[model samples]
Target chain A: MIKLSELHLGILAALGGIVLLFASANFAPLPGQAYGAGTMPRLIGWCAILLGCFMVATSLKHLPEMAKPHLADWVRKPRLAFAALACLAVIVFYILFAETLGFLPTSFLGLLALMLVLRTKWPTAILASLATTLAVYYAFSRLLMVPLPRTEFLSFLG
Target chain B: MLIFEQAAALVFDPYVLGVILASAIFGMLVGAIPGLTATMATALLVPMTFFMDPVPAIAAIVTATAMAIFAGDIPAALLRMPGTPSSAAYVDDAYKMTQSGRGDEALGAALVFSAIGGLFGSIVLMTLAPALAEVALRFSSEEYFWLVLLGLSCAVFVTPSSPTRGLISLLFGLFVATIGMENPSGEPRFSFGNLELMAGIQFIPAMIGLFAISEILRTVTATIPRQKIPRSDGHGIFKTQWKNLKKYPVQTVRGNITGTALGILPGAGADIAAWISYAISKRFSKTPEKFGTGHVEGLVEAGASNNSAVSGAWIPALVFGIPGDSITAIVIGVLYIKGINPGPTIFINDPQTVYAIFMVFILANLIMLPLGWLAIRGARPMLSIPPSTLMPMILIFCIVGAFAIANSTAGIVMMLIFGIIGFFMEENDIPIAPAILGMVLGPMLEQNFITSMIKADGDIFRFFERPIAGGLGVFTILIWTLPLVMLLLRRRKQARLAT
Candidate 1:
């Protein structure tokens, strides 16, 4: 957990602003006008640059205190850190596998894994995951008409 | 009269009414939970809104947000934990009231006054929005540019943290809005050749990632355990509310007025409303010393203020397409999705739908009384649900919702990326509201600026030639310069003091 202080965040923002300006430079101006696609992005870049500079200046007196990064209590604990990662991992898992595995199986797996990681009992995890996956699939796909991805492997269930 | 009848028919239909009822219950459930904000509740409801008629969908959000805002008081009173950020203003007073066995009074005051405040705001919305829209019908690109800039200025200045950080967040959002080909030039600037990126970031998934996912991350990293709710005193929820109302009539009216005014201001919302109203209540109270010691006086005023502000926020959103707060920002997105563009033109185009919406606000507030009563009785059980168990379910909902946005994996990827950005932004004390507002208004700002530039042939002074545009421009500039001027004046004052 590399906690960012005001100074670090400011520097990062300033650098990001510069990068945006350069990238936006490639966008040619619109025809018959002075402004173009680059206009807003460029405006934002300058604003960011000014904001970053202001942040740095205001915090200069407390620069030492503002620059040090401190870990949150959960970040210091491996279990909690993993819990946070598992939350992200589930999303990543769905992104990678949902289209291939289908919405039901992929979602069920993600839910079950997360419940267990969050320390739910196996039975609770299994039952809750099963119920929720079916309910969500129905409510979204059937009721709301949102098309959840169909599984190539598990075609019958969906 | 005929239009009112048409709107009444629209609102009273089985489908829209059912949606409202279901969303109200959903709102109560979400609001009674600590760490789940009203804005998150709105975000979560968006996917469902994607399927329905525009009236029902807007009805759903309207009902849910009003219920959620009021329901937040349940946890605040019972557990000393604010269910939503807006409820936080008077949490100490609410908790103390419960401890002193005046729990019924505290909850009652919160529910009743919230209803009163919400109704007042709705009436104001009903009356003021159309008139404002009529005035806005005359606004050209120059006027819109100034208005958008003013809105952004409000967002930066009204945050709970450093203005510089808020400005950074606002800039980040502005940058994000410039991602696709909808700018002045049709050429995509930052799409990186990704097809989905060319369409630009969908506000729904990005919003879910920011409010929902970042909150989940924060909860996981939280060191504090859930607080135990106090046992019920077995008193009727609304029994003492009448007495309190009689005693605090001035406070109630003042709070309602203050909240509605603030709500009408772009970028300021219910949370700020509650805080300001609570402070005002204390200042005006005869027994100001009793405020934090199990007091119901402050709770009454602030609770009313929050709910009213929720209604107040819709005024600008409906009239000008500028969001009054985070919730209304999401509402504007929904409005656009429904093909009911918000502006003065909306009044001319969809008068019936506008009336239906106004009716929904009144209905949502009216029902808050009964629904809020039930929630109070059920608060203990709801709050007892462990965060560890609850969080996983919410995360699943977030993932599905992200995927459901465009029915593509690309939306999920955007969610993940924005989730990280949101988490990082929160960690750095950059206010998220500005970013959300920036995203909502970014294109509007750019579109107007470009059109005005073309209209004026690159003459900057033309932007200020029109009376309304000049006034708005001056106001925005003044707001932007206020801090810097204050800083300079402070330095000079300090030098004088040292001498």
Candidate 2:
């Protein structure tokens, strides 16, 4: 992840406020009323704009230090960076594949991959992943009736 | 008397007791572990609570949070690492006590005083919330608008950080709340034609992402090395508490009073309460010089405080639907999910449930003695579980928990997006509590503001026409302006000094 400086955050907030103000400009008001849905958004936008300006103004005194965006320490470590990306990938993978591949397979694979990346031993990782996958499957699907995705391959287990 | 029986029957059932026991254990584990907070435990428990009835659901949360706050002292004393932020205030004292082989005394004081404080807060909540709700019952939209604004203002200005950053976080949350067509005009604001977006962000998923997933990301990518847990000579966890109680009667009462007072304030929770109570204990003590070097005075005071604040936070949440802390912010979300609309009317309509919750507070604190002692005895193995193995398991839970909210992938996607946003916010030193509070209160703020506007025919001055509304409005405005006045005064004084 990138570590943005105060100035950058302020600038981004200012831009965001501007965009909000313009986007909500077209919202129609309530019947026979001067304000509508747009009123709250517009208020938030103005507040954001003022806050961003204040932040920017306060940050100007240390302009040189405030302008530089630095990378967090973990971003420089290859192992830790991989661990972070691997965590995100597991979630993204589950989103894309859970419906087709079923919760059991998708969760097991994701958990296994993440555990391995985090340097857990292979045996413990596989066992823990499988156990967790099944436990979550039963808890959510059977107990809570959450309707977690299922496939023919895991139908027997269910 | 009949209502008390009804509430007792509601709380003492087999299912509710079962739920309470399970959540008690869960809260202890989460609170005893470093980096896993009481709020995170509540966020994770929401999914399971989704499957429960109202009483059991609330019982789970109430019990879990109480246990978590006390269990946090375990790691704080044994490892010099607070299991939760609430325990950070007296960590030095607790750890030093352990170093001096007074670990039992330290843990015992924490357990005994924490229960005392919790009971004190619960009594206050029972007596105070109903009375306040009576007044809240007569409030109009104009008054509600000002009240909600006051709560938000307190969230920003009361935070111990840059108000600009807190305001930025709050604005971001309000903007998120405006994503759907839940407004008075019924116009789609930022949905961009997607059905899920039109429904607005799922509060559960967003909460899980913000509190749980962001924590996972930070833990996984952290560079800090884990510390070794110190050896503890544990025995007679309760033997020494009677003497300590007798010795520090004033500190115990003061802690409870200070904690409950701070807890009633919006956005100040157990963590802040503990810090403030510890400071007060030092300020008022004769031996203030012995504060940081294993002094039990500060520990007794702060330990009582953090737990009491847990119960204190429920006051505003139950009475006015304004959360007193982040934990109650999550509780408010859970309440809404259970189809229990929080506010003054809840007292009239669901008096049994309200009383049951009060009962749960007392039960949770009383049971903390046994549960807290067990956690202390078994702390070593629990802390030894490497984060490498635990983070992945937690992530899986987060993924499935998000997915279970609406049985859709859209919830998962929302969790992912908000997780990254929460991580970024924390990295920038922006507080997450105000954002959570904003998300919870934004719709209420908008609805009341618009309702008052319509009722008053767009006349701004009419907002102050009602006496309660006028006083509240003026008070809210004063809170916002007072800080600026102080800032200007200080700056002018600095200039004069320079001259």
Best by lDDT: 2
| CAPRI rating of model 1 | medium
Question: Which tens-of-lDDT digit does each residue in A3-111 have in candidate 1?
Answer: 7777877887888889989998878887866788888888888877876787688778897899787876677788889988999998999888888888889889998
lDDT of 2 by residue, B147-195 (tens): 6787677567534357788888889889999989899988887999999
DockQ measured for candidate 1: 0.59
User: What residue pairs are clashing in model 2?
Assistant: none
The number of the candidate with the highest DockQ is 2
TM-score of chain A of each: 0.90, 0.95
lDDT value, candidate 1, whole model: 0.81
Assess the local accuracy of residue A23 in candidate 2 as a C-alpha lDDT between 0 and 100: 96
Give the residue spans of candidate 1 off by over 4 A.
A63-73, A150-158, B1-118, B121-131, B223-361, B372-382, B459-461
Error of 2 at A52 (Å): 1.5
True contacts kept of each: 0.77, 0.91
**TM-score to native of every candidate shown:** 0.74, 0.74
